[model samples]
Target: MKTTGTVPRLTARGVATRARIVEAAADLVFERGVAETGLDAVLAASGTSKSQLYHYFADKDDLVLAVIERQTERVLAEQEPQLHELDSIAGLHRWRDALVGLQRHGGCVGGCPIGSLVAELAGSDRPRELLRAGFARWESFLVAGLTTMRDRDELRPDADPRDLATAVMTALQGGLLLTATTRSTRPLELGLDMAIAHVEAHRLSRSVQPRGRREGPVDAGPARPAGTSTASRSG
Candidate 1:
């Protein structure tokens, strides 16, 4: 609840202390889950006293919110590169490949950091909204890139970036959940492939395609095993 902008600025050491508490809480929740991770556990893990924890967070829920915010920032930062490259079919394929690779690298152990939170926090209105906002922010990145593609006439005028981005985001979250549950990257790969294909389906006809646009069906890239460390903690 004590956002940086909402509260008085903390000294450098105070900022680090607050961050340590949030990081510790996030780790504990990731390991034992939200319901099992108590404030005492957070205090023990963070090496901070009750007063220190309460000084920053109003309660357990407040601390959890901070953890969610931290995880959201981390997730977005990890995916920013690929998210920015979704302006074309080729770029989208490359982004999809990157996500699948990351899942394989981590052996599909963790579902998306933010997505996993949804399952645990859905009943809690405040946390649920926070998680929703996180997903929306993630979708916005795709929306921006897809908008660029539409602007360039690569996609049909009727192709709504918001809708396309939502489809892609939904596919990603569902795929990640399945991949983590099955300990295989197949679901993630398939989800992204189909999502990209959906986008490609909206492409302009070859006859009307712009001069610089690449011709032919979008290549699915070489058949290879998935592997990437970028989002290892994201799952």
Candidate 2:
């Protein structure tokens, strides 16, 4: 969208070449950051010449937009199943466990694919808007699950799905940042745990505990004598 003009239509081979360029750029940007990654590196990694790269992308900015879109797609694809199943508190915990497991497996190397991009590109309007849209898409999944839970009487009527979703997103991003910085999953676990705890605090009934948690047998105070009224007992 800058000095390089718009991308032209491409044949099948052209499409594949363009995809290679974008994927390579995405990987480079993910590893070295947007500033450190250059078109020369992308070309080398993708095995495409400069002319071919320019044929599909207007400029480095255009390539970056493609990278953001690709990363967004990759992330959402990975999260779609768990995000869709978030209607129950147990399901939320399951999703959290999956996320922690992922970080643990990766040793928390990358904070978040999209989050890293956002951190670098937020100063720019177009990239920021694109990243914001990507985040919105992710948040929508959470909102849908929370809305369903609220409608099903699992959550308090006052619980706002959007607000809770925002809280969860904030916790997740923060956790991922800390996890990557520290190379440990503890921060991520705590973040998700606190977020879920916040959600649980808004449950419709505290008497009914979520799965995997046990409540001690209720001590219903001393039983009242055989149908005796409080007035008679006081007298």
RMSD of each: 4.1, 12.1
TM-score of 1: 0.86
* Residue-wise C-alpha lDDT for candidate 1, range 147-181, written one tens digit per residue: 98888887889989999999999899999999988
lDDT of 2 by residue, 55-165 (tens): 887788988988898898888887767978988766787788778777667667888999988878999998998899889998898899899888877778999999999
Clashes by residue pair, model 1: 101-227, 101-228, 110-235, 111-235
Lowest-lDDT window of 10 residues in candidate 2? 226-235
TM-score of each: 0.86, 0.85
Runs in model 2 with CA error above 4 Å? 1-6, 206-235
Report the C-alpha displacement of residue 185, candidate 1, in angstroms.
0.8
- Over the full model, what C-alpha lDDT does candidate 2 score relative to the true structure? 0.79
For residue 198, give model 2's deviation from the true position in Å: 0.6
Best by TM-score: 1
